[model samples]
Target chain A: MTESQFPQCRVVPLRMLKPETSERYLNEVVKVEGIRRMMVNGPSIPAVVPYGPARGSPNPNSNRRTIKVGDATMELRVQVGSITFEVEDAGVIEEIRKVTNAFFTQFPAQVLEGKFMKTEASLVDYCRYGPNADPSVIGLVDPRRKEAPVIIQGRK
Target chain B: MAYTPQYGPGTSIVAENRRKQMNPNYKLEKVRDVTDEDVVLILGHRAPGSAYPTAHPPLAEQQEPDCPIRKIVKPTEGAKAGDRVRYIQFADSMFNAPSQPYQRTYMEMYRFRGIDPGTLSGRQIVECRERDLEQYAKMLIETEVFDPALVSCRGATVHGHSLRLAEDGMMFDMLQRCVLKDGVVKYVKDQIGEPLDREVSVGKPMDDAWVKAHSTIFHSLAGVAFRDDKEYVEYIQRIHALRTKYGFMPKEE
Candidate 1:
């Protein structure tokens, strides 16, 4: 198995971000160049009560809503816990670190360098995206989810 | 000399808080005031003013069994009235919420009667007769055991205990049973995720300092570290060693 040449890092804040905070943070981070692909991950706030007696009832959560990032408008299904992204090079990580540092003044955040993104597509990915699917789209969205990944046309 | 019970073993503030909660003699400081009607609304078991739906006839109206054990153990009001069994569950945040699952179970067993507590990694559920459950639920919500932000009442989908708190410091509830508005936390939906007819205000979230001090869970980053408490570690180690040795029946040295 071969690994992707691009480096990945995750920016974890001490507190999970509200939708407004997440949008602001994303907008700021996208301003920096060399961020290839990004994903916002956290505990999901379902559109409807998923289980128990109230299953199928509408789940009205303030945290779950649509937010605009650069030229893209996407719905946020989860409370933003951490933002993970694949960058073009190691230098981009430093630029992101500076951006995160300046952004998270109210609370501390860490820019952890590791292999956070899937280097290779799994069986689930194959089933969801098919054999000739774009490598960039792999592992971006949950396989169970029918929703596709959002493309943010950033300034850079 | 008369017997006395030591609730738990620890030197840290978390341990002391745990002991305080588990000791019936140690009165929990009342932090909020949630009315009995509010609790019923949040519980979603029955209407606020409706009579308790019974599972059986009242004990007084039923024939008495000639048993010594039955004679000795007096029935609680709910039991005597034959109220249906109902439950209330709580999910506690790992970030210095006042209590944890096991701690809740232990504390409930010590302080309340006729309760069946189910303890999990992140959530605790207590089941009792509907009438008794309302009284107990009211006490749990209005006392120091509850924090409007870190602690939430969730009957199902209790998935946010170990996750990071939201930017506003409220625990993540998938159902969003409660919402923080204008410095106050209000329950817009019942514990089971059904929308409430009217919002039930449980008061504002406690400050970080108060939560840290009153918290029973030992968190390394947020609150007191478990390793910092030597006595607690020693006690746990001893128990671990004894439990392991007991299986083998080793002779005492």
Candidate 2:
């Protein structure tokens, strides 16, 4: 099936100063009606201490961790710099704005309507995974991951 | 021609600050009081009262090579003592932080001696002999160059320079090395976020007014735009023109 204007996305540029606020905002936004999918963009947090005396040591950074969003839980790889929301219709935009305003107490979101999320997987998806790749994984996967641009399929 | 020294150019307060910090003769106003021991503890190199660890034999003990340049150039205290080279790094917030990476390097080049400073996007690291670095770190901490909220002494994981500040105006430290509690900022850990035996107070962060008045970076969002300063723009253009002209062909004209 091809992508359509009916399933549009509006990227809400959230300037959440902390991970706690991002978690709260995400949890609230997921509860809003007409929401289809979500993805966050920001600087990637390294799994271990990348440099200095504690090289290779487990990072004790409290800000970088897993967060709960409604029923689903996900590990926050990046500091939730901005949240892009895929919605069913333009009507859901107002609900997103309301929820963003309520949860983002410190730094609010500046909602911008655009095609921020990828609708389909690229040529790498066909060559690497041999054309049986899942189309749903196109926008769901983290863009910053090492194997991100390589694969489109959720399964081997 | 008579000798004259010039700092940076600009009519803005940020440029003025850059000039002030770079001018060796101009006295840096001490904003806070940090003891020598506190500096040592924060550096995490050697114990407060420990003997200076040397990389080589002291200059006096070692036979001096009678080179003309060596005779003319005087060795610093640390160099004479043959202390190992150590470093102190700082990350300045983009939100009107008083001292930026390049600004800090320019200031250090003008003021300090026997040093190697590496300037990056957000952080600046100055390497020097252990004793010299300790002394320099103390001055940097005590002066207006440092603001606990807008600046961080991070050896690693220095990511908060470009990030939005915390609610209380403190720069985000993933390690949580420093905490603002009871209206004062205290370091509970070393520069690399290793737990310290006792808390070291870095004092209160400067207010918005102070930071705005002293910021070296011309952040358009923060009200001071690089385009606003005509003289600064012209200076940059002139420098670029001259560099290109000289690079393509070398002549007096």
The lDDT leader among the candidates is 1
Worst 10 residues of 2 chain B by lDDT: B164-173
Please give, for residues A28-146, the per-residue lDDT of candidate 1 as tens digits: 99998988889888988889888899999999888889999998999998889999989999999999999999999999999999998887789977887678766765666654456
Misplaced by over 4 Å in model 2 are A1-14, A102-105, A128-134, A139-156, B166-168, B172-174, B250-253
Ten-residue region with minimum lDDT total, candidate 2 chain A:
A147-156
Query: What overall lDDT, based on C-alpha atoms, would model 1 receive against the true structure?
Result: 0.91
* lDDT by candidate, in order shown: 0.91, 0.79
**How do the predictions measure up, each by TM-score?**
0.96, 0.87
Candidate achieving the largest DockQ: 1
Off by over 4 Å in 1: A1-3, A123-130, A143-145, A154-156, B251-253
Native interface contact recovery, model 1: 0.95
Clashes of 1: 0
Per-candidate iRMSD? 0.7, 2.9
